[model samples]
Target chain A: MILGVDPGLTRCGVGVIEAGANRRLSFIHVDVVRSDPHMSQDLRLLAIYNGLAAKIEEFAPDTVSIERVFAQENRNTVLGTAQAAGMAMLAAAQRNIPVALHTPTESKMAITGNGKAGKIQMERMVARLLNLNTLPTPADAADALAIAICHALRPAGALEGGEREQHLTPAQRQWAQAAQRANHGRGVKRGM
Target chain B: MILGVDPGLTRCGVGVIEAGANRRLSFIHVDVVRSDPHMSQDLRLLAIYNGLAAKIEEFAPDTVSIERVFAQENRNTVLGTAQAAGMAMLAAAQRNIPVALHTPTESKMAITGNGKAGKIQMERMVARLLNLNTLPTPADAADALAIAICHALRPAGALEGGEREQHLTPAQRQWAQAAQRANHGRGVKRGM
Candidate 1:
């Protein structure tokens, strides 16, 4: 099982999925953990930390995947996002779970075959991939599901130093080819 | 007792101080908690969290004062600093201790009567204020000490909406006068 977190101060989205053989993934859980903005920063962070910690305890995920926050984004929200992301990571680490970070572009490309895919497109793709009857509500939750799927589909040894092509499963290769085609054969780096 | 933190991923500085009546301050302890940069980001953050949590447990401070982090600083280090700051806040919150945030300018002005004081000057002033025979070794440690003193000397009800001037101790009034004189009577906002 893998847990993916889309970290934010007001609303932190968490999604859990079980990955089977041959790039198969089954949705296990999805929800948003919220904290009141009126609360003090320490209490707000503690609430988010408690929420994420509870999820980790209940789910017992093997690895936790979190979005890689960048300082280049909206200056007002970046620090809060980074703080929430840190709490998510700490929750996982306290449980001795390894963590993986996936960039937004990587998640979009993994889910929708395009790095610049729109939110609706990404949500629709995530729903279809998970065979869900309804789309994940709130863009943050969908993004988290996409992040989990991205980690689930990642070829082994891709994060480390190795020839990614040699480790790609048939499904991953097919997805990579589709992503490349979607990019107009521009040669999108595999598993980047 | 107040605990001040200068948060950073590689080196988190922590200082404890007791605030006595009439603006008198006594230093208790100061140290730097460090984590290796080569470790995974989650592990590094976890190490920081553990170190801070341990300090809070040992010291049992009434409040934790952390330097407010801004995203405008060095883009590379701001996120890490924010993350470490989050951990510090969480550690305090876990123990139900109140948390205070002071900007670097506030700390500098509180210590040296100058918002733009250089590092050496600030460290010397902090040592003098603490009556320490030796200066705090690392810059981060001195910064933490400054943050603690800043919180210790802030007039009660200054953080909330109130007339700060009515609550200022004689020493605080004297310090404010000195700071104003240092700023060439530019009327620096009190307890801002």
Candidate 2:
């Protein structure tokens, strides 16, 4: 499954697309998960983290594709968006899932055939690609769908790297070592 | 040593404050780590994470206090900020050390006796609190100092409550336990 995530502070548009046998997309689903504004920023981020984790569990997508943040004028605004995007990445990472980050230009080009395509053009392209009558609602959902289609077009050669380095940190790797040191050393607490 | 992080997109400002006995604070280090603008958002966030961890190891902070994000515009911007925040949080959490999250209002109230305070007001208060002749360079560095001050103001009662809630996920307790299980399983597979 190649899942697309359009992450934002207010609402994260998620699209799941399963690239199946015979080169056919066997499944697709789209929805917008809204992040709470009334809560404190930390709580809102916690909501995003848990909400996305629950959604990921429900969808069980083996891979996730998230749009990359491009540019921002306000420093504060950029910080909040970065936090939300990080939470999405962490959610996928915690589940040991593969993630491919797509820049806005790349995602735009994948769906609209032009990097500078307008929002409506990308929406129409996504609708056409998914064989839907009407475009996905509220532009963000359509953009998420387009992002999904972008992942679907990933060349097999690119995927040859095949799901390593997505593991935990070097410290985590150390803890995975044999018990030789555990028993060899005097009883002592090891820092993570 | 207490490490305080004021996460931002272009510049992630950090301050290391040594809170010695008698409630005295000495500036250990102050720095702003910059991320490449052209790199993907994930890479920038990863840079922040790696840089923060290296800083912690270098400074050997006994405590960490990070300011909570409160910006409320541009959903994409918020997501990015949240990503940086999450990365910082994850780094601390992995260390099994308790981390304190302080909001802007609380930090302001602690330092300046006003919950609603501007950046200049904060910089001035920080200068007065630490009795510094000159203001901390760039508002971000001073904000980081304020976060450390916020942690220094932790009452005995506050410490108990805060210590108890280390990574406490009310509803997601089950999920974290499952994750621990998977981690242990991986450890076993790797012959730990």
Candidate 3:
């Protein structure tokens, strides 16, 4: 099982999924853990930590994937996001489960084959890929599922270039080809 | 006892101090908790959380004071610093100790009577106030001590304007007068 988290102070999104043979994915659970804004920041952070810790214990995921945060993004919210991300990472680390960070662009590209894909497009892609009949309400949840899928499709040790095509499953290879086609088509259109 | 933290991923500084009648302060302990830069971000954050958690458990402080972080500061280190601050706050909250945030300006003002006080001046004031024969070696350790003193001098509920001079002890009032004098002297000099 792989768990994906979109960390935030007010509402942290968490999604768990399992990858099967041939790279098929199944969604296990998705939810938003919320903390009151009126509460002191320390208490708010502790609430987030506790909420995520419980989910990790319940799911016992093999690996945890979280959206990587950058200080440049949303200056007002970046600090809280970083703090929330820290809690998510800490919860997984305490259990000895490996944690991975995927950038927003990486997740968007993995799901919609477009690094700059819009929210609705990403959500549609996530629902279609997860084989869900309905959309993942509240964009954060969808974003989290996309993060998890990004991890599942990533080549092992791909970030460090430790793995190559030979290690990719047939399904992942197929998906990679499709993404490349999408990227090429977009590039050509922009060049026009 | 009060615990103060100067949060950073590379070296989080912690200081424990005791406050007696008439606002006298005694330094109990001070140390820096470090996380290796070579480790993964998740593991490094976990190491920080564990190190601070252990300290909180050992000292059983009545309150935790941490340096407030702003995204405007050094973009390169802000995220890591915010994450470290989160860990410090979480460690205190988990143990039910109240946590307070004091900005660098607030700490400096409390220690040196100048919001723009330089590093060397802040260290000297912290050492003098704590009656330490030698200065707090690492800047982070001294910063933590300064944060603690900030909280100790602040009037109860002062941040929210809930308390007034009637509640302040003689020592606290005297320190406040001294700080005002320093600020006035600096203003006069700058005008000249």
Per-prediction RMSD in angstroms? 5.2, 18.4, 7.3
Q: What is the per-residue lDDT of model 3 for residues B120-150, given as tens digits with 9 covering 90 to 100?
A: 9989888887899999978889888888888
How would the docking of model 3 be graded?
acceptable
Residue by residue across B1-192, what tens digits does model 1's lDDT show? 999999999999999989776556788999999989988889999999999999999999988999999889999899999999999999998898989998898787677667788999989878877789888878889899899998887644343434665556454555565655645657443321
Clashing pairs in 3: none
Which consecutive 10 residues in model 3 chain B have the weakest lDDT in total? B183-192
Please report the interface RMSD of model 1 to 1 decimal.
3.2
DockQ of 3: 0.43
Query: CA lDDT, every prediction?
Result: 0.83, 0.65, 0.83
Best by DockQ: 1
Overall local distance difference test of candidate 3: 0.83
The residue-by-residue lDDT of candidate 2 on B67-87, one tens digit each, is 776556455555555566667
**TM-score for chain A, candidates 1 onward in order:** 0.84, 0.75, 0.83
Per-prediction TM-score, please?
0.86, 0.53, 0.85
True contacts kept of 2: 0.27
Q: Write the per-residue lDDT of candidate 1 for residues A85-152, one digit (tens) a residue.
A: 99999998888998898888878767766778898898988898788889998878888888888888
* Per-prediction tally of clashes: 0, 21, 0
Error of 2 at A67 (Å): 0.5
